[model samples]
Target: MENHDAAALLEQAAQLDAGDPLARYRGLFIGTDTALSYLDGNSLGRPLKRTQRDISTFIGEGWGGWLIRGWDEEWLDLPQTIGDQLGRAVLGAAPGQTVIADSTTVVLYKLIRAALATVSDPARTEIVLDTDNFPTDRYLVEGIAREEGLTLRWIEADPASGVTVEQVRHATGPATAVVLLSHVAYRSGFLADLPGITEVAHSAGALVVWDLCHSAGSVELDLDGANVDFAAGCTYKYLNGGPGSPAFAYVNRRHLSGLKQPIWGWMGRKDAFEMAAGYEPAPGIRSFLSGTPAIFGMLAMRGTLDLIEEAGMAAIREKSLKLTAFAVQLFEAWLEPAGVELASPRDPELRGSHITLDHPAFRNVTAALWEQDVIPDFRAPHGIRVGLSPLSTSFAELFRGMAAIRDQLRR
Candidate 1:
């Protein structure tokens, strides 16, 4: 499987696919046409076959048949119910700590604001983050800092390597109130040391918030074990929840009582159905919710979650490492000779499910590849992301995509 020759690598890919334990699960998802190579799963995943059937069933039976009765029977707690299922299968969190609602931006804002509200020290005036974080994350933190009159401690992460634990330690201190960062860098595909950074931020008396938009279902997460104070992520990418799927928010059970999310609505109030005047926050994770759940959008994710739970994250991670490793092997043999450089971390353990390669012509190369039915997304400053979704992608498919990149570079 580690052959340095392209023809040999293609042979190895087929051999690897023959024995792949997760190979059976690929049929569960849609978009299996051999004419294309989908290397953008980190941006948007393919919908599950079951998702279409489930959506039809929901509309016909759950919504159409039950009418308003659906709320009392199942819709009222869809957020928390699905959150628990996601927590158990992907997030490594216990029940009652995660809830699905809002977009990634809204959920991130709520969690960041909730953490900021808990800061009691006047000296804690800094919000630490990296320059390479996702655009929405940076915007939300900048907006919050400007509105709250706080300082932003920017961590200048290497665009290729991402924010490291030492960078976090140096950036956070007594002056830092909240440290926000991506669990995986969106552009470079660098996976951060979640537990180590959380511990460092805690020692500095700052709460940590993670944006899991890139890493959520692609990598194994232990929010509880890492002692992550707050987290927000989207279900559209790795979770395969469809476009415009509801995002999730996680608050450590210990912080539930004290955390005050900025947006308070009737849904977050205790006895919400009673229509009380004063807003008494609902106990536990429900208080983090600000509005009615997106029940329709969440339906597709359930089928994908079922597949994830059945495959197990450990198995998925194992397959991910292999696929990415094979990709790297191909790059060393073919793409590297064409002056294409690896922008993502070379160490497999330091990388996420995706890999980024840099070529001066990548912008145009991406455009050309799209015309030829090989898809990889172009990032700014000459980078192309090769995102591998373990359940839907095969080693042979990965080879085809990498070979296309190599052929285009030769042209």
Candidate 2:
């Protein structure tokens, strides 16, 4: 923990980063406008240069020139096209099982409602979700529970450790129709044991729906291998999709035939333009789409997805671990004695790409850091989240941010 040891550790980290196969991807993003150390990719990712150009081209040609005709050309396929890329790159889903659609909240609502309907037994009327789930997810579930006259079985999760397979098992019973959780916890950055959790849920005859908002781009996900029943995630986070970009939903091919999304909009119907008298949902993931696709938002996501595919999740994950490890090392060496406790798991295998630290004045400290242009997020009751997007953050940036935090705390 001495200065010499910290320096040496940082030096070794820099060497590893330099030799990393994914190092070059850091340049693919707009890192900063004025040397800003952005440690908030878990909240919102840096915009890609390609996204700017792609938007410009789409605006000028696709929308400006082609106008409404663009729909007939390829505008209609945006959901399926981008959804397939998402499946191939991160979701571990087959092509037809994913589709770009509404926000994460909307997708969660649709999937949860659909799962509720599939459970015909009135006795199985409880929806299981962790108390530590993201606010939006919890809100959506609460709304669904109210609408369906179902009770919610909320599992109390350890703020630092997040939900575990055992916690889920204890919460899920024969009367549980669904088990919902975030793949990587939002505040703690804890990576849940997906396969094990899925097994537990399935054993109790409950369908599992994962909110992959944190893990999709920061971690390697094999939804198909895990036999996930359904999943949803926002692209604007680690995926580098621009702000408010359309989120995605995954419906396993097996479930597509059996589970029906609640929203039966014409866009999700087999023949969307047929103006049919009744709603006959489309097959596969396309049925998850509820309304007209956001052309501009999908274009922004396309650029980021291209970059993600090029860098590859394997390489991205490698750099992500390195970045987070570097930050944790710095905190232990410099800030631990000052009462700063690591809230994230020490073992990288149990964590995602971000690190969280606990301090009494976390909200104030985070705000102050932002004033100095060091951006990390704060969760209530004192946790500072430093998210390192492998494609945009650097070891040097992390070192500088930690140093700033240490210096500020000393004052």
Candidate 3:
């Protein structure tokens, strides 16, 4: 019976991979040919094979040859250039409103502060957010509230799901300045209703800022249609830009006028070459810039963004849904019998590109799984996140990883 079950799963994975439209893309990444099962792409994606060649070329030409002149020739506009591409491809945004720079934390801080600055009503002194948001988001809001003498309105969220529109409506009021949220919950892989939540916040006379870390490439984002006020997310995960890659920020075009990001540096000056005294901010999204852009960090994602634009977000989202559904299928068939609880949403529409499983033994099982080359990430309190990146991950890899998890659990 066990052998038959294994054969059935292998057949299911093969059929899924055979019918997959994006399956052709699996081999484009760094190690698709290997037996290494990487189920943690939502935490850190596999690097693109082309990134190596691009880096080699940039080192010999842009850095080695152009030197300081590279700033004048290309580096100055690199942030907005890449930002425009990212906006068009993955963010569902138009040009000139998005800029790529800074860490996601810094970008979130700048946008949150900017949102607060735009509020004219003195009574609107409270920043509303959920308890289950990423730590950086909650921490920034807490510190900012302290700094500006504001109040925090908390929305109690479930670890099994995420923030909902009804919860936002209940938590927000006349005193709410802005609502901070994550588009996709990191732990449970729950995708929040971005447009509905934004509408709720707007109805309460509040702007919305979203953390897009888990949804940028894994799910389809229509930021413009959602009427999002501000947003930030890292590139290292689904964007495949390597570790510590520069993050991107978006501001609605209407908000760009008289908008000032808190961080002001010489590079953000209207005429950075002027070198003259008082810091006059640059025009448009360029003003969001604080210091020199990390050219090296930005290089890898350009290739990935090109791939995203080529494959299109709709197709990517389709494959992501399939991957996670396959994951849940195997989880129920194998891990559920072993006392592993599915920590993520069961519905495909409500889920992001990943899923989590909870078992008391997972606290130690994760390290063991890693030693055997079956890679998934561990969250706090014995939750193992199975992050399936659609572009870089294949159904076969997912099956292998799931089988390994079951084997580990049985021991």
Cα lDDT computed for each candidate against the true fold? 0.92, 0.86, 0.93
Lowest lDDT sum, 10 consecutive residues, model 3, at 258-267
Write candidate 3's Cα lDDT for 144-242 as tens digits: 999999999999889989888999999999999999999999988999999999999999999999999999998999899889999999999999999
Cα deviation of 400, candidate 3, in Å: 0.2
Q: What is candidate 3's CA lDDT for residue 282?
A: 90
Which sections of candidate 2 miss by over 4 Å? 1-10, 32-34
Cα error of candidate 1 at position 312, Å: 0.8
Q: Model 1, range 52-144, lDDT digits (tens) per residue?
A: 899999999999999999999999999999999999999999999999999999999999999999999999999999998999999999999
Q: By summed lDDT, which 10 consecutive residues of candidate 2 come out lowest?
A: 25-34
lDDT of 2: 0.86
**After TM-score superposition, what is the CA distance of residue 315 in candidate 3 from its true location, in Å?**
0.6
Better TM-score candidate (1, 2): 1
Q: What's the lDDT for residue 213 in model 1?
A: 89
